[model samples]
Target chain A: MCEILRLAFAAVFVLVVIITIPTKSMGADKEYGQYLSAECNACHAPSKKSGAGIPSLNGKPVPYLVSALLQYKNKSRKNAVMQMIAGRLDSEQINALAAYFSSLGK
Target chain B: MKKISRRQFTNAAALGLGALAIPNIAVGAKPKVVVVGGGAGGATAARYVAKDSKGAVDVTLIEASKRYYTCFYSNLYLGGLRNYGSIGHNYYGLAVNNGVNVVHDWAASVDAQNKRVKLASGSSVSYDRLILSPGIDFKYDSVPGYSAEVQSKMPHAWKSGTQTQLLKRQVLNMRKGGNFVIVPPTNPYRCPPGPYERVSMVAHLLKANNPKAKIIILDPKPKFSKQGLFMDGWERHYPGMIDWVDPGAHGGIKNVDGNKMEIKTDLDTFKADAASVIPAQKAGAIALAAGVNDGDWCPVNPNSMASKADSNIYVLGDASVAKSMPKSGFSANSQAKVAANAVRGELTGSKVFPARYSNTCWSLIATDDGIKVGASYKAGEKKIDVVSKFISKKGESAETRKTTYEESIDWYNGMTADMFS
Candidate 1:
């Protein structure tokens, strides 16, 4: 009887840990991604074949993108829109975004 | 699956981590969080969740593109003070500094009922909770002749990135003494002062590059942000280079013939060498798909930044109904922090507090000369309220001008660091 009780408790413990662990891990990435992408699409199109005055992001070189962002952040670029954005980022984030775009099929 | 109460976990963590009073709290296993956007609101929110949750949240930011171009400084590019590259940003730090899994994939759809999001790669990600901050979308249907096709020719460079740069290029390439007509949108659009400020910046450029060029603004609203200040600057800086027509003054857009570059109004029909028709806008498509946005913008609880439609979701940035705060990048970053804190609290069962938000927008009238407006906010019952506001004094002293300029740079760095770093 003692052995059975111990086994039961152990099984419950394992099951609870297994289920709650994933929930705790998922965090807000999905929500944040959904929100942010929608916001960005307001302006940027993944392609160069955008309608009207919108520029195409489909095939721009990664290095060029990175350089442009750094200039904006350093205040060498001086546009209000660019300043606000470049001013917001650190070096690490700039690289990540650059990597993502470079990987896209331009 | 060892279930422990909040106090028990705290005690355990405290004892285990030693003198740090590391609460003995056994944090539930970390959940995988995937954020789609890396702009103002998304970046800030991702940082908040990952930081507050410690290792309990595995955040993966999935932005289709790597770099972000803010709409805030595009006007500088228009004014020839900045370049297109200056406004871009990256998201690598979110992964390295915050342990966020930053993915570069297109999120095709969100399956809310299943708690899963679909990506372009045909993969699906399941989450305990989701946040959607997709921002704004142009409603092409509102205007008859302003579909995507017409926009290609008459470029409504209202949105950021390429459209903006293209518009700048077109303006730069226009013949000297040519007409550049800017059709400002009606009320409840993305940046109220944006069109006027843009005209100011463009007029400044035209004055220097193409002195004989003209800019006519057709505004739907009678009143706008710092109207007096803008008019004063236009008169003093770029006299006769810019003209403004408010709908009340018969300046509203009636119809457009894209081929002819003609715009008809109540009183007159005007044709231009170039025209920019900034259309009406609403929340992004995904927000609509998720049923987060009722109409154009998603409505959220001001204090928590949580959605009214679903408790499991939060909305921020231009996509949200954060009226007390204007729909600008600064406002988005501020609101993102609030939303991030609230999400962290929800996940950890920690105490969630009311939030305070602030926004400042600086517009350049000339290369060195600029104007600004700022407001502080507190959460009200249903909305955020502007508690305090300020603007750069009209006649800026040398000291004030220098300080404002320096502060703008600091603000850019500080705010971006707060969001992405």
Candidate 2:
């Protein structure tokens, strides 16, 4: 009985640490990403319904956004507006944006 | 395949309780931000700072008029494409929904050192940060013989209020086969493409109503924004009805007699039944009174939009000398966002991003015929320099032009919503 109780307590503590650590870091990243993404709302609509022709960034996969931004920075993407915007962002910013935008619902 | 036992589920639930142990960060007092001139710049700046700060900052907007008539699409109103009421926006939504204190009063002057503004009502308001977006005020003497007194006869409908209505009435009531003269101001005026767009709109109005009427453009600059597109549009839509005279061809405007409805140039004197003499422009009077102006405009840092004279005050829109950015509503709105972010970052513990700006000016020539010129900009050491630019070609498919026109309409709606709502 004593051994079982000790095992349950240890399992719960490990689980809480596992869940809380990533959540805290991601929460901070998402908040900063939101601040950085304000300018993007000028051209790219935040919602899917209003983003015809202009691509909607909300709820996209993180990898897809990272790839797209990288292409824009590398000049593989042909849009001048995206090129100008993406050229200013670094790798950390790109990851944060991807994480924040992907976390949203369409 | 594998199912969790009841004890495992109980352990997972117990783990979730530890997630709520994070302490809340303490923020002491609210910072106050005051914005003057509730146009595109002021309205957007106030809304963003208030909404994004999440009650961390108190924002107040001081505008002389309750109803703001945007000069962006007023030309379309004259062309009969848009109604007069469609271009006007109110501040009720900003006040009620966004928690912005909208004061309908004129900002008479600013005490930058002490960070207080004196209103026309004799009340003074203090602010931690001040945003001045007092759009352009015309230089009355820029065009000889044209002043406030003479505006009744030959209107300069640049401000988009009663002047716009008067100009529209004059255009509609022009005598048959009469000439309509448009005296475009020199460069560095509000809305570089605006005067030409007005010419296009007037041409459209005339072509439909009085087909025999002619339009003569007396321009100070040799070329104008979207010149190729406008020339193409005029030829395709209303050929032989428009005549453009550059400075080289017709010398500079010598004088104007509003009563006689005659404009004299070095080459010849032209008479018109109606005329729009858009005068040269300068920063709004309040900006000069605040002692933030270099000459006719206020200089600002491109990255932060902080006034060169005073760090506490930020100047936006046509009133500031933004080196590469054209003085348009879109540019103002863009600049407002940058300034708002910087201001919020300073007041709150929020993160700040590098400044990037963009603007697209759209013009409608005739029904479903539209063209646009746009550029994306980044902050340089000295100015906001353009990174890339695109313009509509002279000849494009009807479908493309139609799409561009529709896009402009959508943009107007979206931009107004962004500013006021």
lDDT of every model, 2 decimals: 0.71, 0.85
Residues B290-389 of candidate 1 have per-residue lDDT tens digits of 7888777899998878889987777888888998889888888778777766665555554343476777787767655667787767799878987666
DockQ of predicted candidate 1: 0.03
Which portions of model 1 show Cα errors greater than 4 Å?
A1-106, B1-28
Q: Over the stretch B1-421, how does candidate 2's per-residue lDDT look in tens digits? A: 1112522443444344222212222334467799998988899899889988888788999999989999999999999999999999999989998999999999999988889999999999998789999999989899898899888888989898889999999999999999999999887988999998899999999999998999999998999989988988999999999999999988999999998999999989999988999999999999999999999999999998989999889999999999899999989989999999878766664555668788888889999998888887889999999977778887788988887787777677667777887
Model 2, backbone clash pairs (residues 3+ apart or across chains), number: 0
Stretches off by above 4 angstroms in model 2 are: A1-28, A43-106, B1-28
Per-model TM-score versus the true fold: 0.74, 0.85
